[model samples]
Target: MAARRASHAGSWYSDEAKHLGKQLDNWLSAADLCHGPARAIIAPHAGYQYCGACSGFAYRQISPVVVRRVFILGPSHHVRLSGCALSTFTKYRTPLYDLRIDAQVYRELEATGHFEWMNMSVDEDEHSIEMHLPFIARVMENFKDSFTIVPVLVGSLTPDKEGLYGRIFSRYLADPQNLFIISSDFCHWGHRFRYTYYDRSWGEIYQSIRNLDKMGMDIIETLNPSGFTDYLKKYGNTICGRHPIGVLLQTVHSLQKSGNNGHKVSLKFLKYAQSSQCCSLSDSSVSYAAAALTFE
Candidate 1:
């Protein structure tokens, strides 16, 4: 079976297994597991130096032993896809280990008639989904062979389409054995990004950016997809993975509508950081946030 190589490794992150493992271990150890045994997580997908440590707060919540399948939903940065796509490869090669894709789940999703297949070139070129493989491999290392992955490359979906896909995946979200990882990075600020929303009332430019992101994060914690949509429409925050995050919100909303076994579900933001504080309009920086969704 063909495997997707860790093409971004050695540059985006370390290629050496020992060094990468140690880095993940240190970050995971530093993060406090406050809202864990996560049913799902929303974490950043930037390079390790930029968002890796911040992402640990999300991964640290996983009860790896209980999870048998991981569903990774990430945005498409390089490709212009109108709908969601699934991986064609059987395995994904990370520095630590190769993660097997769940063929059974792929078959089921394909049967839905709503998914598309991504060829090897498109799969290898996208970094949003690839960035999370090493972390998943490390967190589930002990039971690595016991679990399989489902990687979904979400496209520029309309809110209606997001709900459609959400309803399609709601069953898996209800399964305690499944875990969802939503890859996203919040707010790209600066002239280079062509977005410089500044409110002097927030004191500084970076503070304004923080306030803007916090507003969006708060909406996500409410588990209201429309609310998130409204926030995005209003501020136009440069959240690269807004489509994937919308799908996750819609999934939770669908589960709630179905009563979801009467279980209470809550999503909380655990960590937030910026690559650099944007002090001027000419400066550029990307925001990273880590959140966990728990079912109680």
Candidate 2:
């Protein structure tokens, strides 16, 4: 079977299995399982040095024994896509181990006729999906052979398209044995990113960014996709994975609407951090947040 190489392994993270495994174990060990046994998670996809520790808060919540499949939905950074695309490779190689792609789930999604197939080059070039592979491998190591993954590259989509894909994935989301991992980073602030919105009342520039991101996070926790859309429009926050996040919100909404109201699903953010503190207009910083979606 063909495999997609861990393209960013050496630079973004360690390529050696032993060293990388130890690093990930330290991060996971440091995190407390506040809201656990997550059905889904929203975690950052930056390099190990930047978001690795923050991502632990989200991954630590997983109950690996029960999971049979992992659905990774990440933004398409290199290619322009109007809808979602699935990986053609049978497996994704990581420093830790190779993760098998669920061909059965792929065929089922393909039968829906709404998804697209990503070529090997595009699949390998994208870092958003690949960054989560190591963490997924670490968190589910004991049950490694039992679970297969479905990686979906989400494109820039309209609100209607988000709802469409959300409805398509809702059936899989309903299954307790399936885990959804939404890859995203929060606000990208400063002139380099061409965004410099700061409220002086918030005291420091980073403080302002935190408050701004907090507002959006609060809205996301409510599971209101329209509200999130409005927040994006109002602030124009450079949330690269907004579309994927929107799709997850709509998935929960779709589930609740489809008579799954009795099964309560709640999303809560556990950690937040920035690459740097943007104290001035010239400084740039990328925010990272970790959240868990749990069913009560």
Candidate 3:
């Protein structure tokens, strides 16, 4: 079936099929691709060299011969999307392989009155979700049929709106067979990103930035919902996708409580490295992290 083509193939990742597949294999083999039965993954959306390893950890763990359907949620980076955007395409094209969207479930969620717009068109050029696909393809050979997706973009989600989208998404993916994913980069630091005050250069300043990100990390480590919001508002820590993370956590909490047995949510930090930490450029860079949270 003809569907959307790869938009970020050359820029964010490799455009060549062999290079893409080979690198995907190497990265997949390196991470915890076979970790315990998982329910959700929080992966980054930055460039391949920068954040690929971190993002690969979650996708590799969740995709290998298990699970069906992943509800990928990310914020609108290029354009501010209104409401949640569902994929109108039958299949999502990735450099590694194609993954289908669960049409039946998509239509079902569409009927729910909790959210508005249903801006399915926003998936076009939406690399937040697309970036995770190649990693998924590397793990699940029959990925197209093995797992489907309910791709949604979180753009302008107010508190009320996030709750609304959470409920609708909860209902749609409540089945025991599904997984959830929230695509996000933890914090953007440095003067270039404007997340930190020490602007000239963060060379070894990651120590200071680390202290700042600790505010966000504490919330993640302790699952402190309120403090997380407080820190985000106070520091203006351009996390870019806190809306999706909050809604996913909130939804998972509700779903487990209402289920026969509570769903388990555990977030593990796979890798945490800033561009400045790893590269010569320390003056202006973003903090990149890879983490996987399981919704049991």
TM-score of 3: 0.86
lDDT of 3 by residue, 22-66 (tens): 887777677764554566677788888988766667666564455
Where is model 3 poorest over a 10-residue stretch in terms of lDDT?
A: 113-122
What is candidate 2's lDDT per residue for 162-217, written digit by digit as tens? 99998999989999999999999999998788899999999899999999999999
Model 1 scores what on Cα lDDT?
A: 0.95
Higher-ranked by lDDT: 2 or 3: 2
* Rank list by TM-score: 1, 2, 3
Model 1, 33-152: lDDT tens digits are 899899999999899999999999999999999999999999998889889999999999999999999999999999999999998899999999999999999999999889999999
Clashing pairs in 3: 33-60, 263-296, 264-296
**Whole-model lDDT per candidate:** 0.95, 0.95, 0.69
- What lDDT does candidate 2 reach at residue 212? 94
Tell me the lDDT of model 3 at 99.
82
